[model samples]
Target: MSTFQAPKGTYDLIPPHSATYLAVRDAIAAPVRRAGYGYVETPGFENVELFARGVGESTDIVTKEMYAFETKGGDRLALRPEGTASVLRAALQAGLHKGGNLPVKLWYSGSYYRYERPQKGRYRHFSQVGAEAIGAEDPALDAELVILAHDAYRSLGLRGFRILLNSLGDAKCRPVYRAALQEFLRGLDLDEDTRHRIDVNPLRVLDDKRPAVRSQLADAPLFRDHLCEDCRAYHAQVRELLTAAGIAFEDDPTLVRGLDYYTRTTFEFVHDGLGSQSAVGGGGRYDGLSEMIGGPALPSVGWALGVDRTVLALEAEGITLELPASTDVYAVPLGEEARQVLFAQVTELRRAGVATDLAYGGKGLKNAMKSANRSGARLALVAGERDLAEGLVQLKDLTSGEQRPVALDALVDEVRKALD
Candidate 1:
C-alpha cells in the first residue's frame, strides 16, 4: 500500500530547517511584544460574512481566494484569508475594546488559509505574525506600526525589503475620488468584468496588472491628488515620522493592497529579490472596519509579517540565521544495566535545564556514537557495566574529541559546568 502524503500546496516543517522558521517567527514577534501588544488568537474559521463585510465584497479574497464553507449545523464559516478582521472581531466579542485602553494593542501568529495556485512564497496555507492597534486613529500610531515592522525585518538581518506607502483617503473624500476614478475606468476599453468592477470599487481596477489595463491607467486619477486636507495631513505626519526615524519609503500612488478595509494609510513591505510575489507582508489603517463588522466605531492600524515569505526573503539575501543546538548532550547506553543508569542520568540532566537526547534501540557504541554526532550535541555520554560499577560515566566532548570520567552523583553538575 502506498503512504498518504500532505495535501497539495502544503508543507510539513521538519527538524533542522523548522528551527529556522521558529527563529523567524520569534524575530518578527519580538518588536510587537516589546511594544505592549498583547497576544491574541482566534479560531481558524469564522463567519463567512466576516470577510464578505469586513474584507469587502469587492476584494478577490472575498470573491475568489477565501476558503469558505457551510457547517453541518448550517452556519456559514470561512478559514481566514487574513488577520485584521478576525482579530478585531475577537477584541470586540471579548469586550477588549470596552477596556480603558483606547487602542487595544494585540498581536497574533497563526496559519491562514486561502485557495490559490501555490508558488514560491505563496501557499494554500501560510503562517503570519500580525499586530493590531484597535479603537484609535493617530498618525503616530500608524507610524509606530510601520517602524516596528521595519525593525522586525532588520532584526533578522533582512535589508532587501522596501516599504511602499500610500493613502487611500477616507470616507469624506474617497467617494469623490471613486466617482472620478469610476468615470475614467468606464471610458477605457475594458472587459465586461473590469467595467463592472469599476462600478463596485474603482480603486481595485488600479491594481490590475495586465499590460492592457496598465497602459490605460497611466493617466488615471490618483488618491494622493484627491486626498482631503485631513487625509493629506495624516499621511504627511506618517511620512514625516518615518523619515525622521531614518526609514526610507517610496510613495506608491496606486498600492491598494488586496483588502477593502484599508482607509487613509496603506503600506506594503516588498523585497526586490522575491520577484513577482514581492510583497512579504503589509497592512494599513482600517478606520471603518469596526463599524463594518457591527462593532462600535473604532479606528485601527495593523500589519502582518509573512513568516514563510520572510524566510524566503532571508534566503534571497543569502543570509542564514544563527540557531542554537537543539541537543546539548546525547546519551549512549551500551548494555541493559547501563541503559537504566544512563536513562535516569538523562532525565536528571534534562531536569537541570540541559537539552539532552538518548540513543535508543540498543545500538552498538559505534552506531550510537554516530547518532550522537548527528544530533548536533556538544557532549556525548557513554556508559557500560564496567563504568557504572565504578560509579563513573564517560563524558566525551564531541567538539574537541576529548573524553573524561565524572562521578555518577556529580553528573548533572559536570554537564552544566561543561555546557556553561
Candidate 2:
C-alpha cells in the first residue's frame, strides 16, 4: 500500500521550520495588536459571489485562480483566496459599522488559498497576516497601517524590503481617468483578453506584466495626472504622513493593486531578494467596497502580509530568528520505578511552568540521552533505581557537560535555578 502524500502545490508545515513560520506570524501580528487592531477570524470558504463582487470578477483571482466549487446543495463556494472581502463580509454581518466607534480596527492571520502554479514563494495554499480599518476614511489610518507593517518587518531584522506607493484616484475622478485610459488602450495592438480587460478594468491594462503588452504602455495615461483636486490632496496627505513617520516609499505610477474595490492610497511591500514574486504584502483604501458587497458605506483600508513570502524573504537575507527551545529539560529514566517517579516529576515541572519532556519505551541510558539531545533541550534529568534509593536524581547540563546530584524533593526547584 502506498502512503498518502500532501496534495500537489501545497505543503504541511513541519518540524523546526514550522517554528519559523509561527515566529513570522507572531512578529507581523505584534505591531497590529499594539495599535488597537482587535483579532478577527472568518471562515476559510465563503459564498462565491463575495469575492466576485468585492475582489473584481475580471481579476485572475476570481476568473482564473479561485478554487471555486459547487456543494452538494448546489451552493457556489470558494476557498478564500484573499482576506479583505471575507473580513468585510464578517464585519457587515456582525453590524460592526453601526457601533459609532468609526473604523472597526481588526487583525487576522490564516491560510488563504489560490490555484496558482506553485513555485518558491507562490503556493496553492499560503498564509497571510491581515489588518483592516473599516468604516472610516482617513489618510492617517492608511499611513498607520503602512507604518505598522514596516515596523513588523523591522522588528524581524529585515532590511531588504521596499515600499511602493500610489493613489488610484477615487470615484470622483477615476471615471474620467478610466475613459481616457480606455481610449488610449484601445489604440494599442493588444490580444483578445487584453482588449476585453480594457472595457472591464482599464487601469489594470497598465499593470499587464507581459513584455509584449508593456512596451506599448509607455505613454498610457497616468492616474495621478488625472487625479481630481480632492484625490490629489488626499494622496498628498497620505504621503506626507508616511514621510513624517520616517517610512520611505517610492511613488510608482502604475501600482494598481489586483482588486476592484481599492480607491485612493494603495501600497505594496516588495522584497528584492524574492525574484518575480516580490510582493510580501499590500492593501489599499477601499472607500466603496462596503456598498459593493451589500453593506452600509464603509471606507476602509487594510493589508495582508504573505507569511510564506516573508519567510522566503528572511531566508533570502540569511536571517535566523532566535527561537526558544521546545524542551527545557529532558527526563531519562533507567528503570520502571524511576520512570514512574520521573513521569510524576515531569508533570510537576510542566505545571510549575518549566518546558519538560520525558523518554519513553524503556530506552537504555545511551539511547535515551540521544533522544534527550535531539529534543533541543539544554539540560537532562537522569534517574535510576540506585539514584532514587539515595533520594536524589542526577542532573546533567547538555551544554557544558556538567553533572550533579539534586535531592529528589528539590528536583523542580533545582532545574529552574539551573535554567535561570
Q: What are the per-residue Cα lDDT tens digits for candidate 1 across 96-183?
A: 9887878899999999998888898889989999999998889999999999999999999999999999999999999999989988
Estimate the lDDT of model 2: 0.94
Give me the runs in candidate 2 sitting further than 4 Å from their true place: none
> Distance (Å) between predicted and true CA of 390, model 2?
2.2
- Residue pairs in candidate 1 whose N, alpha carbon or C atoms collide under 3 angstroms: none
- Among all windows of 10 consecutive residues in model 2, the one with the lowest summed lDDT is 200-209
**How do the predictions measure up, each by TM-score?**
0.98, 0.98
Give the TM-score (vs. native) of candidate 2.
0.98
Which candidate should be chosen as best, given lDDT against the real structure? 2
Q: What are the lDDT scores of the predictions, listed in order?
A: 0.93, 0.94
CA shift at 112, candidate 1, in angstroms?
A: 0.8
